[model samples]
Target: MQFLGAINFSLPLLASATETADSSMVLAAVLLSLVVIYLASKVGGELSNRFGLPPVLGELVSGVVVGVSVLHLLVFSEGGTDSNLIITFLQGTAGLSPDAAAGVFAAQSEVISVLAELGVIILLFEIGLESNLKDLMAVGIQASVVAVVGVVVPFTAGTVGLMTLFGIDALPAIFAGAALTATSIGITSKVLSELGRLSSREGQIILGAAVIDDVLGIIVLAVVASLAKDGAVDVSKVVYLIISASGFLLGAIALGNFFNKSFVAIADKLKTRGELVIPAFIFAFVMAYLAAAIQLEAILGAFAAGLVLEETDKRKELQKQVIPIADMLVPIFFVTVGAKTDLGVLNPAIPSNREGLIMATFLILVAIFGKVITGFVVFGQPGINRLAIGVGMIPRGEVGLVFLGIGSSIGILSKPLEAAIIMMVILTTFLAPPLLRIVFPDSEAVGVASELILNTSGTPLAVESPTAINSKSNDAANPEATPDGH
Candidate 1:
C-alpha cells in the first residue's frame, strides 16, 4: 500500500514538471528575435543608402521595431510575451534555477556592455583620426561659446521645465537635463561626410564644438550620478574627476606622441608580413585598458591614440581595418541598448505617482531647443546657416544611452523614467539626419577648408594666396574664366 501511494504521488509531480517546462518557452522567442534584428539591420542599411540618410538611423529604427514599444517581438517581459526563450534555454543548459537566472542575465549584460564600449571607443577613435586639429583650433572660440550656451541653456531649461511641468524632484530634473548634454560626433560626422560638407567651415566648427560637448557631458554625468546617490554634491570628487580627465588628456598627448614616433621607427626597421597591424591593435587595446584603470573614459584614450597616429601614412589603412570591426560591433551595442529598455513601464496603466509622459516631453524639447539655439552663436561667421549647425549637434547617440543605462542601473532613474529617457534618445537621433539634410542641402561649390590656419588671437586667419586673388580678378574681368565661380 505504501509503494502504491509513492507511485501515485510521483505520477502527479512528474506531470506537473512537464507542464512547467512547456510554459518556460523563452528560448525559441530569443532566437527568432536575433534573426529579426539581423534582417532588419540589413534592410535598414539599404533603405538608408537609398534615402541618403545615415545607416545608423535605419538601424536604430529597426531596433525600435523589435523593441518593447513596438511589436513586442524581442524583449522579454515577466508574465507577458514569451520572448525570452533563448535566455531561458541557456539558463537551463547551465543548470541555473530561476533564482540564478537573474545573475546569468546580469553576466550576459556585462559582455554586451563590453562590446558596446568597444564600439564607441572605435567610433571616437575614427573621429579623432579624421579630425583636423587645426580646423578645430580655428573654430575653438566660436565652438566654445556654442558648446557652453548649448549646455547651459538646455540644462537650465530642462531642470526648470521638469520641476514646474512634471513636479519631479530636483535631482531627477537635473539628471534629465544632464542626459541631454551629450552630442553624438559620430552621427554628425557621417551626415557632414554624406553632404560633402565635412571639410566646410561650418562642419569644422560643429565637429570642434562636439568634441568639447562630449568632454563637458562626461563631467556633468559624473556630477549628476554622485548627486543622485548622495543627495549632496561632492566637491572633491568633482575636482578629482576634472583633474583626472585633464591629466589623462595631457598624458595621452605626450604618450601618444612618443609612441607614434617609436612605432613608426619600429615599423620601418622591421618590414615583416603583419608586424605593423598587430602592434597597432595592441597599442589601442593597451591604451584603452590604461585609461579605464585611471578611472577616465576609455574612449578618450582611444581618441588620443587615433590623434597620435593621424598624420602617419598607415592611418588610412588602419581606419579601413578598424571600421569593419566597428560596423559589426556597433550595431550590437545599439540594439542591446534598445533591448534593455523596458517600454512597458511607460504604459499609462501603471499607477506610478510619477508624471512620466510630461517629463519626457519636457526633456526632449529641452534637448532639441538647447542645441538649436547654440547654432545662432556662431560668432560673425558667414556663408553658413547657424540653425543648421546647431541642429546637426542635437543627436545624443551612444553617449546618452550610456548615461541612461548607468542611471537606471544605479537606481537614479526608475524603470518608467529610464524608458522615457530612451525614447528621448531615439527621437533626437532619428530627427537629426533628415533635419540636417533639409537645412544644409547638397552643394558641390561649397568645399570645406582643407586646413585650419589660425591667427594669434585663435581666430581662423583668412589666408589668401596671390594666385587665388589673381584668379578671382581674372574671372571678374573674363567671363570664360569664371566657370560660374560667383
Candidate 2:
C-alpha cells in the first residue's frame, strides 16, 4: 500500500514537470525576437554607413521597421484579423490563454529594455575610459569660461523661449534647456581630428570644454531628474543637488585612485586574463547601481566611474576589452529609441501631430543660437576660430538621445514633446558637418590661428604646430560621410 502511494505521488510530479517544461515556448519566442532585432539593426547600420551617416542612424531606422511601427515583431495587436500571426502561433505552442501570451510577450520586451539600459551604461563607461582628466584640467580657465557660458546662455534661451512661446511647463521647459546644453565630445573630437587639428590650441579648448560640458551636463541631468521625480523644483534641492553631485564625483575620483593602486598591486596575483578590465567594469556597474539607488541618473554614475578609472594604468586594457562590448550593445539602445519614436506624430498630414514639427523647428533654432554664443564667451581669445568652436559644439548626438530617452521613459517628456526632441536631435546631428565646413571655410588660416593659446586676458601666444592626428581627411572632399556624425 505504501509502495502504491509512492508511485501515485511520482506520477503526478512527472505529469506536472512535463507540462511545465513544454509550456516554455517563450524560449523560442525570445530567441527569435533577438535574431530579428539584430539582423534589422545590422542592415540599418550598414545602410547608414554607406550613406555617410553614423551607423546609429541606420540602427534607429531599422528598429522602427521591425518594431510596432511596421513589423510588430516586439509588440502585437489585440483581437484583430490582421494581428501578428507570430503571437498567435506562440500562444498555441505554449498552450497559453490570450492574457498569458500577452504577458509573456511584454516580459520579453522588458528584457530587451533592461539590456538597452545596460548598453548605455557600458557606452558611458567606455567614454569615461577614453577621457583624460589631466588633459581636461590643463585648459581650465578658458575651457571653464566657454563651458559655463555655453551652458548658461543656451539653457536660459531654451527655457524662456519654450515657456513664453510654447506654453510648456517650467519642468519640461527646463528639460529642453538641459537637453540643449549637451555637446557631443566624440563628434567634436572626430571633426577636430578630421581637420587635422586635434592637438591645436582651439582643439584643446574644444576638447577641454567638452569634458567640462559632460560633467556639468550630467550634474544638470541629476538635478532635473530630481525635480521631475520628486514633483517639486525647490531652490534648496537644487543647491543640494549641485553640492552632492560635485561631492559624489570628487569622492569617486579620489576613492577610485586608491582602488586602482590596490588592484595594480594584486594584478600579478590574479589568475584571470581580463586584468584591470574586469575590475574596472565591476566598479562602473556598482557606481551606476548606487546612483540609481540614490535617485540620481545611472549615467552620471557611469560617467563618474569612467572619470575615476581615467587615472588607471589599465586604460589600454580596459579600452580593448570594453569597446567591443559597447560597439555591440550601444546600437541596440539607439535602435530601441528609434523604435519608440512614433514617426506618425511628426507627420504633417496628421493634423494633431503637426505641432511636433513646429516644436522641432523652434528647438532647432534655440539649439543653434544657444551653442553659437559660446564662441564669443571667452573674452579676448584672439587666434581662435570662434565660429568653428561654436559649430563644433552643435551636434547633439548620442548623449542628447540618451538624455531624451531617459526623460521620456521616466514620464518627464510627453509623446509630442519626445517626437520634437528626436527631430531636433536628428536635424542638429546631420546638418552640423556641412554647417561647420561652411562656417569655417579657410582651414589653413584656421589651422594657423588654432595653434595659438591665450595665456592671460588679452595676450595671444604662438606655440608649436600641433602634431597631425590620423583623421578622416582621406575623404575630406566627401563631407557627407564625415566620421564626426555621432
Candidate 3:
C-alpha cells in the first residue's frame, strides 16, 4: 500500500513539472519571435530608406521574406506551423516534444497577434498627437465628400461589375464591394508622415476623410456580416452601429477639454518617472476600451484620446515620452501584417488558381480607379495634388483582410473570389508608398528631414536638408511626426 501511495504522489509531481516547462518554453518562443521581428523591421526599413522609399514598405517586404510565403520564420496557427522555423528550432533545441509543439505555437501566435493589435493602437495614438484637431475639423466637409465618394464609387462599381461580369451571387459580391470601402488609415498616415506632408491641406483632407471612411466601413461590415450570418439584415443593429460610431467620435471631441485638464492634473500630482506618459497611456487605453465597447475600432479611441491630449500644455513632452514606447511596439504591428500575408495565391500555373488570377486583375483595376476618382471630386482645394489624395485612400491593407476573413469564415466567397480580394489588398498595400513618393517628388527630396526628434529646447524639431528646407520650410517643419522617426 505504501509503495502504491508513493507512485501516485510521484505522478502528480511529474505532471506539475511538465506544465512548468511548457510555460517556460512559451515565453522563450515569444522572446525569439521578437528578436526575429525586430531584426526584420530594422533591416527592411534601412534598405527601404536606401532605395528612396518609405521604411514601412521595407518592413512589409521584410515581413514577407520571413513569413509563411518565404522563409517561414514567422507564421500563425491558421495554416499550421508544420513548416515554421521557430517551431522547428524549439523542437530541436528546446527539447519540446511533438505533442506539446502545436499548443506552444498556438500560444505564441496568440501573444504576437495581441502585441500587433497594441502596436497599431499606439501608431494611431501617435498620429493623433501629431495631427492638429482644428485642422482636421477645417477639412471636415471636403473630407466627408471624399469619404462618401470613396465608399459609393468602388462599392457600387465592384458589386455591380462582379454580378454582371463574373455572374457572382449578390451576397458575395456585396461583401467584396464592402471590403473596398475602408482605407487603412494606419498605413496611409504613416506614409504621409514619412513624406513630410501630414499637415498639408491635402493631407488634412485625406486624414479627415479616412476617419469617416473607417466608420462607414465598420457599419457596412456589420450589416453585411449580419446578413451573411442570418440571410437577413438586422436593421436595429445597423442603426446602433451608425449611431454609436458617430456619437463616440463626437462625444470624445466634445469632452476633450475636460479630459485634457484632468489628465494634466493627474500628471502634475505624480512625481514618478513615468508620471506623464503612464497617465496618458491609461487614458488612451480607457478611451480605446470604450470605443471597442461601443462596437467601434479601438484604434479610433486611441486616436481620439491623442486628439484630446494634444490640446494640453504637455503635448510636446508627451510626444517625446511616447516615441520610445511606440518604437518598440509599432513595428510588431507592421511586420506582423506583412508576415500574415500569403503570396501563394498570386501564382497562375495551377489550373484552379488561374481563375483567381484573372479575377484579381479585374479587382485590382476597380480598387485603384474607384479610390483615385475621389480626389477629383474634392471641391475648392485649388492646385491640390488630387492624385495624391485619391492615392492616399487606395491601400486597404489589414482592413481588407478583416472582410476577407469574415466572408471566408461564413463560406460566402468562392476560391477565386477570395484570392482576388487578397491580391487586391497585397497590390494596393505594396503600391501606395512608392506611388505617394512618385506623386510628391518634391517631398521625396526632403523626406529624411520629415522625421521628428527633440532638440535642446525640449520642443519637437525637424531636421532638414540645407537646400530643401530653404524652399520648403513650412511643410518640412510640420510637427506631425511618426514614432521611430519613420
Candidate 4:
C-alpha cells in the first residue's frame, strides 16, 4: 500500500510547492491510479500465466485485488458526483466541503471508464482488420444455424427453468435466459488467439456465430425489455429494433466500402504518410458512435470497420497499430469488471441472499448447457474439437453485462436476479479458458506473449502510394465496383 502511494513522480511541479492540492492534484491522482492499475494488471497476469491460465482471468483478478473490492486503494463512493474512489491514499483533501470531492470522484471514474471502453473497441477492431467478409460469409449459413440454436435453446431453457424449477416471474426468467444467449466473442477470441486458433476454420466459425449471436441478442433484449416495461411486446417496435440493429451493420459497411477509395485518395492527397490507421480509427469511432446512436453495441461498429478495411491491403499494418493500444486498455477494462463485482454478495451463508445464491447456481448450470450444445453443430472433421468450440462460446463477456444493466435500468431485473446473472457471467468467464486448455492439449496458448494473434485471412496493410490511391479512385469512378469485390 505504501509502494502504491509512493508514485509521486507524476505530480505536477507547480502543485508540489503549494501548501494545498488543487484540481491538478486530481489529475495527478488519476495518473497515479493508472500506474497502480497497470502494475496490478501485470503482476496478476504474470502469476496467472505461470500457472498456465489465460492472463485475461489474471488481469480481472488483479482488478478485484487492486480495486474497491479488496485493496482499499479505490472504492466507489455512493451518491458522489466526484471521483469513484478516495484519493486520500494518494493526496489528502482536507478542509474541503464533502461536495468538493465529487468532482474528483467523477473525474477519475469517467476517465478510466472511457479508456476501458476504448480498449474493447480496439480489441474488436483488430479482430475485424484480420478478418475478411468472404470467410465470414463462407460460414454465414452455418454460423447462423449455430447462432439461432444458441439463442433459442438457452432462452427456452432459462425461461422454462425459471418459471417451473425456480418459480421466478416470467419477466426475470426471460432476462435470465436472455443473459445466457450471448457467446462473448471478446473472451472466446482471446482464448482462440492464445491457442493460435483465430485463423483456423473452427475459430472462424465460432467468430461468425458469435457476431450473429450479438445481433440476435440485441433484438431479443429489445423485445424482452418491451415485454417487461410495456406489458406487451409490439410487433412494429420489434421490427424497427431489428431493422435499426441490422441496418447499422449493413449500412456502415456499405457506406464505408463505397467511400473507401475516395477517403483513401483524400488522405493520400494530404500525403501524411499515416497509411490506414488514421482512416481506420475514424471509421471505427464514427461507426461505433453511429451504432450506439442507433441502439447497438459500439464494438459492432469497430468490427464492421475492420471488415471494411480488410478489403484493402492495409489490414496487417492497421492491426499492428491497433493491438498495442488494445493490449493496454483491454486489461484495464477486465480489471474494472473484477473490481466492480461485489464479492460480499457471493456468499450463500448470508441468510438474506440465499435465494440469490440458489438462483445464480441454477442460471450458471443452464447457461453452460445452453452454449455447450451449439458446439455440437460442427461438421465431423479431424482436429475440429466440437466440444472445444462449444466451451469457447460459453463466456457471456460484455454482452451479458449490457443485458443486466438494461434490465436494472428498466426496473425489471431485481436484486436477486441481478446477483444470479452476475454470478453466471463471472463463473462462465473464469471457467472457459481453463476448460479450453484441457480440451486443446496441443494448444500453443501458453507461449507467444507479444503475438497479436490476428486473423491470417487477408492481405497485408501497407501504406498506399499516390499511384495506388489514384488506381483505387479510378476503380471507384468506374461503375463496375462489384459488391463481391471481384
lDDT (10s digit) by residue, model 2, range 13-131 = 43443344433655666566667768877898667656654454566678778765677665422211224445566777756667665545544444556566676676656656545
TM-score of each: 0.75, 0.70, 0.90, 0.82
Model 3's lDDT to the true fold? 0.81
Q: On residues 1-486, what C-alpha lDDT tens digit does candidate 1 reach at each position?
A: 000000011334334433444233333333445566667666765587577665556666776666666765445332234445445666557454675454333333333344555666666666566665555667789988888887899889877877787677787778877877888776676556545455456777788787667667767877898888887788887788778766876676667546766887776776676666667767777776776676666666666676677666776566556655666665654554455445555567665524566566767888898899998988767545688888988987656766675676677676556666776776787788778877865332222222222211111222222232224321222122111110
For 1-486, candidate 4 gives per-residue lDDT tens digits of: 000100111224323422233566557666877887788888987787788776767777887787665774544433122234456644354443454455455455555666666767777777787666776776677677778888999889888998998778988888888888877787677666655556555667788888888888877877888888898988887798788877876786687567767766665666565555677788789877877677677888888888887776555566667665666777766776666555666877776468888888888888898888887876543445678768878887656776787787788877788888878877887788788777766444222222233421122211212222224322322232111100
Residues 1-486, model 3: lDDT tens digits: 000010011334434434644878888888999999999998998899788888889988999899989999889776544677898899999899988887677767767777888888888888888787887998899999999999999999999989999999999999999888878888888877776667677778889999999889888888999999999999999999999989999998998857878888889999989999988899899999998787788889999898899889899889889888888888888898899888999888877679888888888999999999999999976667799999999998878988888899899999889999999999999999899888877764343454453321123434342333335453544345433333
Which pairs clash in the backbone of model 2? none
Of candidate 3, the 10-residue stretch with the lowest lDDT total is 1-10
Question: What do the candidate models score in CA lDDT, each in turn?
Answer: 0.61, 0.61, 0.81, 0.67
Order candidates by TM-score, high to low: 3, 4, 1, 2
- Residue 364, candidate 2: alpha-carbon lDDT: 88
* Residue 449, model 1, lDDT: 25
TM-score, model 3 to reference: 0.90
Error of 3 at 479 (Å): 14
**Maximum-lDDT candidate:** 3
**In candidate 1, which residue pairs clash?**
26-84, 26-85, 26-86, 27-85, 27-86, 199-448, 200-448
